[model samples]
Target: MRWSAAALAAGQILVGGPVAAAPTVVIIALLAVVGLGVAVADRRLNTAVAWRQVSAVLMAVDLLATLGLVLAGLLQGNDELWVLLVLVVLAAALRYRIRGALAVALGAGLANGLLELLVNGGEPGPVIVGRLLVLLVVGGFAGSIARELDVERRLYQRMAEASQDIVAKRDEDAILGALARHVKDALDGSRATVHRYTLAGWEEVQLPDVLSVGSADGGPPLLTDEEGGVSATLHRLTWQQGSGRQPNRLTLPIRLPERPAEYVVAVEVTGPRPSALAEGALLALAESSAVSLATRDLIRHQEASNRRLERLEALRTRFVATVAHDLRSPLTTVKGVARILRGRREQVAPEQVDAMLASVERQANRLNRLADDLLDAARLDSDALELKLTDVAIDDILRSVVDDAGDEVELLGTPGLVVEADGPRLERVVWNLVTNALKYGRPPVHLCAETDGDQLTISVRDHGRGLGPEQVENLFQDFAGSGDPDSVGLGLAIVWELVEAHGGRVEYRPADPGADFVISIPRERTPGGSDR
Candidate 1:
């Protein structure tokens, strides 16, 4: 506004010759200086509180200047001075659009027409009427264009704000919902719905339907129903904007950069077809939402990885403590017994010495059992456990584990039960189960085995505190124990893994007073074995 006004002022001064009207030149210069100073102040302060007031005051100045120009031109007989008035009207149209055009147009038109009649005391000529008409036409035309520019400016501002809002969000679903909400706000829509692309097709994600949940697959394939990829998707969006067919539902595809297309953010508009700008906003929102999703997905994966690391750390800590505690008891017994026998050999009786040696043997066996379990568990964890199957007598394996049926423990099974099996591993399984029964259960422990056709079934039963219905589902999973601090919980876990390796399975039965663990393996004999 200032620059144009200054140029016009310079031209008028030159046309009328320098010093034609010093007062008029000073007034135009003062207006430019004042306008430029106020505009710069407003920008620096970053405030528009007094903008309306300042605009009104400036319009008032414009009017006063126009009347002054009219009088100055008449007095100097310089008719080109009217151009300054035309510049003011044109400036108003570009600046204030609607109201600016109206005020400046009214002011300039009246100054040319009515002021001429009052000053010259007669009818205004064709020049005055023509200037008035021109000002009005320019004002009306530029005002409409200015209004459109303002609308576009405000729309772009809103899109930017919405983009900022979703960028700060952490969850992918929340990001989609926020974008959908803003897109719905831009249009006349009730509520926006976010859909996750799935193999089953577009599935609603918000307040998710768990029973019929959607997974990330080909998101809203309707976009890519045609041959092309992104082009077809965009073409579909354009069609929806103008396609009277699916006017009620508008879907926009959201995709990650340098990756496959992801999900869709959709809005259901109740009113007429959305304007092009509204659709453009939705498209912008889709892009912003896609970026938010990618960011959130990265953060989510990082969090999951951190949690897994933490769990692994805890597991290692627990495992080390358990191993130390479990082996210490047997080691202490073995060491104490050996020391007593060595130091008091002459004082001890023959039977007492034999008993002490047997006790030492039992403790040594317990230590060895723990060591085997630890090694087996490590092998199972690494997926390296293997079986050495042979034609072996099952009855011999079970009987060898416990020849003397003590008062509390009993072994019951068929005689000469033979099958293709790993004899030592089979013995280890029986020993672990029996030891577990003695340590954990209120025995009356029974280790039973039978053969039904070609399938051999072996069961260990005891009356004890057993698992409840809701206790644990993954009973065979490692570390799933009864929380007994003295016992390492890998007994049952190793039992299950070892059984599975033998083409067999282990099952637990919830009895009334205790629990029963049953193992079943193939009962086939080795083809080339002697029938001894």
Candidate 2:
């Protein structure tokens, strides 16, 4: 019945006589008040003592109230009625498990029976006796059912909690250990082992042994021929009997899904056969545990792969640095010889001199540029490029870069754009951009700069075919140039690296007739701590 004040008042009026009803009413009212108070105080009852003690006190008070009703001759002394009291006592006993509930049941039964006999002047009628017997039977049956249900509920709760714990764990060993213990506990076995099959052979994992169960000494030999590779099977095995030894035999081989019979589970048990439900539950848990284990293993492998890739990249950067260093001296010597030959061109045969000097200078300059590019790439890859910070007019840097290009490309931009950054690196960035525009793009490449608030943006727009989405996505990556093989792919990568070193970023877009590269740098206050 739904519990409320009205229900309690009605129940008291029906069971208790008019003379005794007032006290009962007052007690019920007090209990209702106390219950509400307890509910309010529950938030503070975080400690175990409060939970256990408060509940015990409440149950005791309820039992005592029932006893008082019997004493006052207010309650009917029918068997069915008494049986209901016993059931209540049982429920209270189960929840609180206090010694008082037992006393209440026994004492109330004897006292109420005696009171009924005294008031009625003798033994009650057959109807009353039958009601008493029915009460006893019903109470006992209800109590038994409640106990069994509680056990089942607890078991299900434990399984759910265990599954949650397993899923939350990332460590492979801990997950396996917990899974093995869960299997062993559920199956009532001394041990449970998990064997994983590989390309070479079956590898036995001593999961149960790790959980401190059976001796890791010996077990049924797991071979490739075992049930044709770990299919679903159960086998009974008897240990070799020795002197002074009892026959230590047990049922083995509970196969999990996705694993071959080669993945054997040897459960040590004293019984002849495990229950059907237990066997099924054990197999299911094992299968799920295996999947979790496999997922964790894959994650571990991926982490290892990432570590190796990082190491390889570091080695490549070092190799590039070393090669650039080695080539610098030879390149310098070759350039020096070319310059000397060019100086002496007039003294030599006119035709051969011009051509020879020109060829020599061109090859030497190409070699020098290759060496510089390699060195720059290495520095960029290792993040070792240092910037010399300064406050410089953006127009000056643009003019310098354009002049260095020697009329190879046209430049267009506002004359007075200013920014606070590493002047040399910024110049290099602009030079690389303009050179790239001339080398890969059609003529009349345009340069522009703009400023807003605390940021300045410079753009180089080319008058050639625009880049596709794929090229734009990978434009800043090393060796990611498009078009002819004659073009070295490190120019834009260097530009991106230098700009980033200055705390700036580079972006690419389709210029109406070609491609546009834009660099945006934050305009910080000068080192004197004053905003520009």
Candidate 3:
């Protein structure tokens, strides 16, 4: 406004050059100085009261300056400075509505009228009255336009605020409740609800009242009735009572078509029905809420999947490192012994040759066992493993495995116990348990077997430090238990699978000084013998 006013003042001076009115130049300069000062002050303070007062004072100064120019006979017809009066009225209209515009119009018109009257010795005339009327008409029209624009601005602001609130909540419950309340407040409804259909039934969330009644017993069936078309889904329903009571209900679908689950936002209005504009705003809010919920669920699922992948990747890395180390140690030993025999065969004694050959054989066996474990894991993945089933003596397999392990293993319980299983798989399971005990446990590993009810119980107890905190349930997960580089951690996993295939279960019994692993297989009946 200041810049435009300055341009008008410059134009007035250019047109009045021959007339060289010093008084007109002085008035225009004063107007510019006051306007600029007030504008700068308002920017610095930025207070409502200060700007209002400044606006009023600025309008007054423009009015007085225009009147002085007219009285001096310098601002002639179509002088361009006349346009400054209209600008002042328009600026006031936007800020202060009709009343502000009227004030500007009256101040300018009355100043002109009084100056004319003073020149005419206080006589009323049609020219003064006609100009005043024109000013009033212009003020009224501009004010009306500003009022309409203010309404649209407010409506959009309200919607924007509600959207910001929805985004700020992290959890599902807060989002639903906030969306419901915003809709109710926007449409001037008495109560609002957000209903969702789950496996159990419909759940309703509302302000001041939250309920989760089943679909069968819930009072209103509007949500469960399954509205078909778009209009049926997002339309209004009216309920009337005998006592001249009526209420308006609005429903909008939260999700789009072909959704796995159904959701609706319902509102109840006790007063006049909402206008079409209000309904549109409410529907937009519901659609936004639906998209938000879908996005939140997607992010959560992705995070869970990423965590699982990270865990598997860590396990895979550990498995590779362990296998490489286990294989390399035996290979290194075998390579050293073979080099000794090949290079120094003539000088080495006969007895030393035998000892070196035995060492090579033991290391080769270790490498072979490692290879077998990897092969078993690959077969397990492809489901190509089959068991050779037969009736086996459990006590015989356990005793034989303990003896072959070459450790101070104590065998407890009677012999001659039999069960239905693959002999080689059962023996392998016992060998795995015994190897684990010898590697990780202290001395005095105990192997026990007994008949219990309809099953035979075989247990291996190791008198060593029990399992670590991370080694409990994950002991059977592939490459999961011990942190030892020599142990590939696949023995226990294979043992678990073979036992489960034989209709048996493997369990860990916690003990004070060590850990006990128990395997129970259903007792087998012989041709001429009763159930064991």
Best by TM-score: 1
Mind giving the per-residue lDDT tens digits that candidate 2 earns over 130-162?
544544554455556556556556555666776
Candidate 3 per-residue lDDT, tens place, 240-269, comes to 211233245566667633554366666655
Tell me how candidate 2 scores on lDDT: 0.60
Q: lDDT at 221 for candidate 3?
A: 29
**Could you tell which candidate, 2 or 3, scores higher by TM-score?**
3
Q: Mind giving the per-residue lDDT tens digits that candidate 1 earns over 1-532?
A: 5565555556557675654467568768667756775776578645465675666667667656655666566656655666667667766876688778867887788777775676567867787778878878878888887887777677678888989998989876667667767777666565455556567755556434221122243234233323333222322353344244433556677765455455665555667665677667667767888888888888889999999798667767777887787678778877887898889889989998888787667777667777888888888778777767778987787776664224576778787888787777777887777877777777788888998777889988889987776544867777766667554467888888878777788888876677788999887644653221
Candidates sorted by lDDT, descending order? 1, 3, 2
Off by over 4 Å in 3: 1-155, 188-194, 204-253, 256-273, 305-313, 332-366, 379-400, 422-424, 468-473, 482-489, 523-532
Candidate 3: the clashing residue pairs are none
Each candidate structure's TM-score, on Cα atoms with residue i matched to residue i, is 0.78, 0.47, 0.59
- Clashes in candidate 3: how many? 0
Worst lDDT run of 10 residues, candidate 2, spans 234-243
| Residue 523, candidate 1: C-alpha displacement in angstroms | 3.4
Error of 1 at 86 (Å): 6.3
